[model samples]
Target: MDAEIEVRDVARRYQKGGVQALEGVSLRLAPGTFTAVIGPSGCGKSTLLKLIAGLEAPDAGEVRLAGQPPEAFRAGGGLGIAFQDAALLPWRSVEANVAFPLQVLGRSRRAHAARIRELIALVGLEGREGALPGQLSGGMRQRVAIARALVSDPQVLLLDEPFAALDQILRRTMTIELQRIWAERRITTLLVTHGIEEAVFLADQVVIMQGGPGRIAAIVPVPFARPRGPELFADPAFHALCESLMAQLAPIADSR
Candidate 1:
């Protein structure tokens, strides 16, 4: 598969003293590849995602999604995003929130009704359509967010700490669920997360970023085969790879 997302020699800066958020950062993602980016808090992991999502522009270099600008791609419904915040409207029911994006794209309610239902079901919220965000548990809210992100049937998915707020057990289950969802769709995905274990468990490749002025430190290909589950946690190879990535991030974390 060819690269679906590409960031070439990109740079960004803001504030006095020319504080750079990222410098000469470059990356590429293949079709259907799940990539997790891990780095210190100031490493601009989220900024990289925003740049790809067309929420921000890079100061230098080019960012392309399958040969088009990020905005153009997203405008065509080729991108989806889920963030840590969930950001659901408190008054909107789960179904309405999931259908918001499709509606914004000029899709009629009739045209998108089936897609919205499918997405809600896909995220395991089949029975919660009438419930408001306040009525749902944190995990359920996150599922609704995920469903909203996927409702557009985007070609790419960008997740920034989407499961950070869940309890450990719920997080693990959600991770398993996300893996299954990804398996079924095979959409190219880029995830920015702080969890080393989660990065290793869900990613085909893990990207390590240097903190001071974010740049690629290393790109580690995960050794495990796909259809991964909680069972992989006990495998020696899984622990070994997780430890290796942890060691690589140690200095970066300490410096922050």
Candidate 2:
């Protein structure tokens, strides 16, 4: 079952001298849709993702997954998250790392063996399952992380800068690969990214944020058809939209 995410008038503040991170930030992601949040540093992008992931509580307002609170839905194994760092255990093989979520939930590994294998192949790490994280390259390690995240068959997937560390070429490749993987199973996905082009490419809607107590600036719907190919990157309309989004961000940049 796919899940929807809702953030309603959310606010957060750090206790150390009341550093406000987010204020009146709200977003709703319909079931099986992809939404990407983009903004400058200190814009509370990761803070919002963490809130949806149940890692922190808002000082005010609420976040819900499938109409239930984040913690309640997460307890049922409905959420999956991947971060910028692959964060794989150096000692664990690709296959073992991908299976780690099941281990954490106390599910029998044998019962999920086929699911593990499918996710490995899905992420294009098929024959390298036995390879340890130390043996894989940066992109490959991130692939392992992605496979691990999806192994739980989550209804909602959250990603924070999942491809930010790669070189330009590798990052583009991984972005395309991510789109392909996402097409296969349209989980409700929320990605927080700094790359404007990346946000425009992978998201159904591109959400722009402003800092100094972060809040939504705009939500631009992506009109391109999918499976979005490499050629879309070259399309004039694509560049036009990118330029328009850049224009919106310019003032925000100037204000910072």
Candidate 3:
């Protein structure tokens, strides 16, 4: 099967060789799959995501979305991103904030208005449509960010710690909600996160990264079925994947 997302032998350097953010890194995501990338900070997790998003140019190697350049794919409105920061415009109401992407893309506001409403409802923020970003809690803002990302129905979704601002309990709740939302769309997704359980629970494949000038240390396919729920936590394989991922990240903590 052809990969929906591919990163081949990618190397990126910053500050004229001050730091080799990534070197010889490779990755692939099958069409309609969810993949999570985890590693110590500065391991180039975000860099790789940026390269795939066409936000940065790799010093070497290439990133392809469906065998075409990221820019070309994105030009067709095939790319979407939700960052850890909600990055909502404080003055805009939730509805307008969710509709911001459409406005930026010069899409017809009337044509996509129903989709904007559907996304707002999809993210469970229907009643808060008129609320301002400052009026909502951190999690709600992230929800708005998510709705903004998906309102355009991009074929590939890129997420970077979209739930990082929430507390543990809320983060878990949002994680489950995100899974349900993702199930509805089934877009190819790559998420960069620090939460092992989050990564294991949400990913079709959990990629563990280690070493400087980051490279894929291991990739473990999730063993559970889709539309996963809390019952999945009871599965032995779920706990095992969590434990295994923690083990891989353990060394990074110890060496620090």
lDDT of 1 at 27: 92
User: Per-residue lDDT of 16-81 in model 2, one digit per residue for the tens?
Assistant: 877799999989999999999988888899999999999999999999999999988777778888
User: What TM-score should be assigned to candidate 3?
Assistant: 0.95
Q: 86-118, model 3: which lDDT tens digit per residue?
A: 899999999898888788788987898889889
Worst 10 residues of 2 by lDDT: 71-80
Best of the two (1, 2) by TM-score: 2
The TM-score between candidate 1 and the true structure equals 0.96
Cα lDDT for residue 19, candidate 3: 87
Better of 1 and 2 by lDDT: 2
Error of 3 at 71 (Å): 2.0
- Most TM-score-accurate candidate: 2
Top model by lDDT, which number? 2
For residue 129, model 3's alpha carbon misses the true position, in angstroms, by 1.3
lDDT of 2 at 194: 86
- For residues 205-243, what per-residue lDDT tens digits would candidate 1 score against the true structure? 999998678899999999888889789988999899998
